[model samples]
Target: MLVTGGLGFVGSHVCVALAEAGYDIVALDNLANARLSVLARLREIAGRRISFVRADVRDGRALAQVFRRRPVAAVLHFAGLKAVHESVAQPLEYYDTNVGGTLTLLRAMRQHDVRRLVFSSSCTVYGAPESLPLTETHPLRPANPYGRTKMIAEGLIADCAAAWPELKYALLRYFNPVGAHPSGRIGEDPLGVPNNLFPYIAQVAVGRRAKLNVWGGDYDTQDGTGVRDYIHVMDLAAGHVAALARLESQPESFTVNLGTGRGYSVLEVVKTFERVCGRPIPYEIRERRAGDLAQSWADATLAERLLGWRARYGLEDMCRDAWRWQSLNPDGYPERPVSAAETRRRRSRRRS
Candidate 1:
C-alpha cells in the first residue's frame, strides 16, 4: 500500500497501523511539515522499515515513477496543506496542493490500475454545521479555503469513481485528531506554531510555549468556548485501516465520519490536560478565528455500522497520551538541514 504524507502526524500513525496489519508500506512525503527522523522512529515502533519516497504529491512525474517502481494495491491519500488559518491567508497554495495533488494522484492511480483509495477528509467540509452530531448526509458548505479544497478534492474522487466504475474509494471525513501513539515514540509535530488546540496545549504543557490561546469565549457552548470532536490519532489511524479493509473486500465506495461523537470545549480540554500533566496550562480568551465554527461534533454511526470502527479513547486518555509524547520529546522533532532537492522544489514553487 502507498501512504502519501506518510510521515505526517495522522499519516505516520496510520502507517504504523497498516504495518501492524501485515501490509508492506511505501511512505511518500515532501517533508514539508514533517521530520525525516520520523522514518527512524516509525521503524522502531512498527519493527520494520517503511519504504519512503521524498517528493511532492503535486508532482505528477514523481507520482508516476512511484507507481511504476512499486506494486501499490491501494493508496491512503493524506498529503496536503491543512492549516485553516493558513489557508485563509493563502488560498491558491492550498488549492494547488490539496485539490491539484488529489487530481494528480487519482490520475496516477488510474494509470497504474490501483483502484482502492482511502481519502483523509475533514469535518471542516461541513462548515458551520446546521445541526449537531454531524452525519455523512450533512450538506458540504465549506466556509474556508482549506475546507473548500478538501470538498473539491472529495468531489474529484467521486467524479473519477463515477467515470471509472471499477474504482473503489472511501472518503473518511474525520474531526479533530488529537493525542499521540501510546508508546510516545512518535506524535503530532507541526511546524512552528500549531493551529489546533491539542498540540498548542501540549506545547504549553511541555514549556515550548508560554501559554495556550483559547479562541473565543463568547460562543454559544456551555463553556462559552468553541467545542469540537477530538479523536485520538491512534483511533483515527485504526479507522483508516478499517476503511481500507472495507474497500478491498467490498465493491461499494462509501463516505463516513470518524470521530468520538462527543464534543469537548476549550476550557474542558485545558482542565483535563492540567490534571493529566500535573501542570497549569495558562490560557487567555481571544477573538474567534475567522474560519472557525462555534461547535461541531460527529454522529459517526455510519463509520461504526459500515467500517466497524468507533473511537475508544476519551478526553482524559487523549490528554494523557499527548502529555506523554510532549513530555518525552520536549522540543518536538529534531531540526535537520533542508535537502538540495527540497530547496529546488521551493524555488520552483516560488517561481511558478
Candidate 2:
C-alpha cells in the first residue's frame, strides 16, 4: 500500500497501525510539514523497515513512477496543507496542494488501475453543525478554505469513482485528532506555530510557550468557549483500518465521520492537561476569531454500524499522551542537538 504524508502526525500513526496489520507500506512524503526523523521512529514502533519515497504528491512523474514500479493495492492520500489560518493567508497554495495534488494522485491511480483509496478528510466539511451530533448526511457548508479543499477533494473522489465503476473509496471525515503513540517516540510536530488547541496547551505545560490563548470565550456553549470533539490519534487510526477493511470487503464508495461524539470546552481541555502534566496551564480568554463555531460533535452511529469502530479514549487520555510527547521533545525534532551552530542558525532565522 502507498501512504502519502505517512510521516505526519495522523499519517505516522496510521502507518504504524497498518504495519502491525501486516501491510507492506510505501510511505511518500515531502517533509514540508513533517520531519525525516519521524520515519525512523515509525520504523521503531512498527518493528519493520518501510519503503520511503521522498517525493511530493503534486509531482505527477514522481507519483507515476511509484505505481510503475510496484503493484500498489491502494492509496491513502494524506499529503496536503492543513492549517486553517495559513490556508486563509495563502489560499492558492492550499488549493494547489490539497485539491490539485489530489487530482494528480487520482489520475495516477487511474493510470495504474489501482482503484482503491482511503482519503483523509476532516469534520470541518460540516462547518457549524445544524444540530448537536452531526451525522454523515449533515449539510456541507465549509466556512474556510481548508474545509473547502476537503469538500472539493471529496467531490473529485466521487467523480472518479463514478468514472471507474470498480473504484472503491472511503472518505473518513475526522474530528480533532489529539494524543500520540503510547510509546512516546512519535507525535504531532507542527511547523512554526501550531494552529490547534492541544499542541498549544502541551507547549504551555512543557514551558516551551508562555500560556494558552483560549480563542472565543463568548460563544454559546457550556463554558462560553468553543467545544470540539477531540478523538485520540490511535482511535482515529484504528477507524482507518476498519474503513480499509470495509472497502476491501465491499467495493463501494462511502463517507463517514470518525469522532468520539463528545465535546470538550477549552477550559475543560486546559484543566485536563493540568491534571495530566501536573502543571497549571495558564490561559487567557481572547476574542473569538471569525469563522469559529460554538460547538461541533459527530454522530458516530454510521461508523459504528458500518465499520464496527468507535472511539475509546477521552480528554484525559488525549492530554496525558500529548503531554508525554511535549515533555520528552520540547524542541520538537531540532535539526542539530542544541549545538552552538544550530543555535546561531535558529537565532539568525529569527532575526531575518
Candidate 3:
C-alpha cells in the first residue's frame, strides 16, 4: 500500500489501521502541512517500521521513482491542502496541489499499471446540501475552491476508470473528522491557526487561544449555529481500510459517504467539550459567514452496504479524545516543555 500524506491526521490514522491489518505501507508526504515525527508515532503505534518517502505528489519524477522501486498494490491519495478559508485566499495553490497533484499521481499510476485507488473526498463536494442527510447521488455543487478541487479530482478519477475498465477506484466522501487516537500519541496538528471548528475549540479549551468564535451563529438550526456531521478520525480511517478490502474482491469503481449520519451544532459541541473537559468554553455568536450552511450530515447507508462500515463514535467520544490530545500536548507534536505560567493561563482562561 502506498499512502500519500501518511504523516497527516487522517493519513496517519489510516496508516495505523492499514498496518494493523498486515498491509505493508510505503508512505509519501511533502511535510509541508505535516511533521516527520508523526511517522515515528505511527511506527510506535503500528509496532512496525514503515517505509517513508519525503516527496510531494506534484513531483512526477519522484512519484515514478517510488512506483519503480516498490511493488505497491494500491494507493491511498490523501495529500492536499484542506483549509477551506485559506483555499479562498489561495485558489491557485489549492488547484495546483489538490487537482494538479492528483493528476500527476494518476498519470504515474497509469504509467505503472497500478490502477487501484482509494480517494479521500469530502462532503464539501455537496456544498450546501439541497436536502438534509445527503446521499451519494446528491448533486455536487462545491461552494469553495477546496471543495471544487475535490469534485474535479473525483471527476478525473471517474473518467480514468471509465477509460480503463481495469482501473478500480473508491471515492470516500468524508464528513468532519475529529478526535485522536485513544493513546494520545498521534493527532491532528494544523501548522498555523486552525480553520476547523474542533481544533479551534480545543485550542480555546486548552488556553492556546482565548475564546472560541462560533463562526456563524444566526443559521436556522437548533442553536442558531451551523451544524455538521463530526465523525471520529479513527472511524474514518477504518472506513478507508474497509473500502480497500471491498475493492480487493469486487474490483469495481464506487463512491460512498463515510459519516455518522447525525449532525451536531456548534453550541452542542461547545457544551460537550465543556462537560468533557470539566471547564467552560467561553464563546460568542457572530454573523453568519458567506457559503456557510445551516446544517449538513450524510446518509452513510451506502458505505455500510458497500464497505460494511458505519461510524460508531458519538460526539462525546470525539470531544473527549480531542481534549486528551490537546491537554496532553498543549503544543502539538515536537513536544516542547511549556512553562507553568502558560499552562496556568490556558487553565485560567477556561474559567473566564
**What TM-score do all the candidates reach, one by one?**
0.95, 0.94, 0.94
Q: What lDDT, from 0 to 1, does candidate 2 have? A: 0.90
Tens digits of per-residue lDDT for model 1, 244-329 = 88998887999999999999999999999999999999999999876678999999899999988889999999999999999999
Mind giving the per-residue lDDT tens digits that candidate 3 earns over 1-352? 9999888889999999999999999999887777767888899999988999888899999999999998989999999999898899999999999999999999999999997999999999998899989999999999999999999999999988888878899999999999999988988877678889999999999988899888777778887888999999999999999999999998888999999999999999999999999989999887778878889999999999888899989999999999998888888998433344655797799999
Write model 2 residue lDDT over 224-253, tens digit each, in one string. Answer: 999999999999999989999999998878
What are the root-mean-square deviations of the candidates from the true structure over C-alphas?
Answer: 3.8, 4.9, 7.6
Off by over 4 Å in 2: 336-352
Q: List the residue pairs that clash in candidate 3.
A: none
Angstrom error at residue 276, model 1: 0.4
Residue 345 of model 3, lDDT score:
94
The 10-residue segment of model 2 with minimum total lDDT is: 334-343
Ranking by lDDT: 1, 3, 2
Model 1: lowest-lDDT 10 consecutive positions: 334-343
Winner by lDDT between candidate 2 and candidate 1: 1
User: Over 4 Å off in model 1, which ranges?
Assistant: 342-352
Error of 1 at 63 (Å): 1.5
Question: Which candidate number would show the highest lDDT if scored against the true structure?
Answer: 1
TM-score order of candidates, top first? 1, 2, 3
After the best TM-score superposition of candidate 2, give how far the Cα of residue 44 lies from its true spot, in angstroms. Answer: 0.6
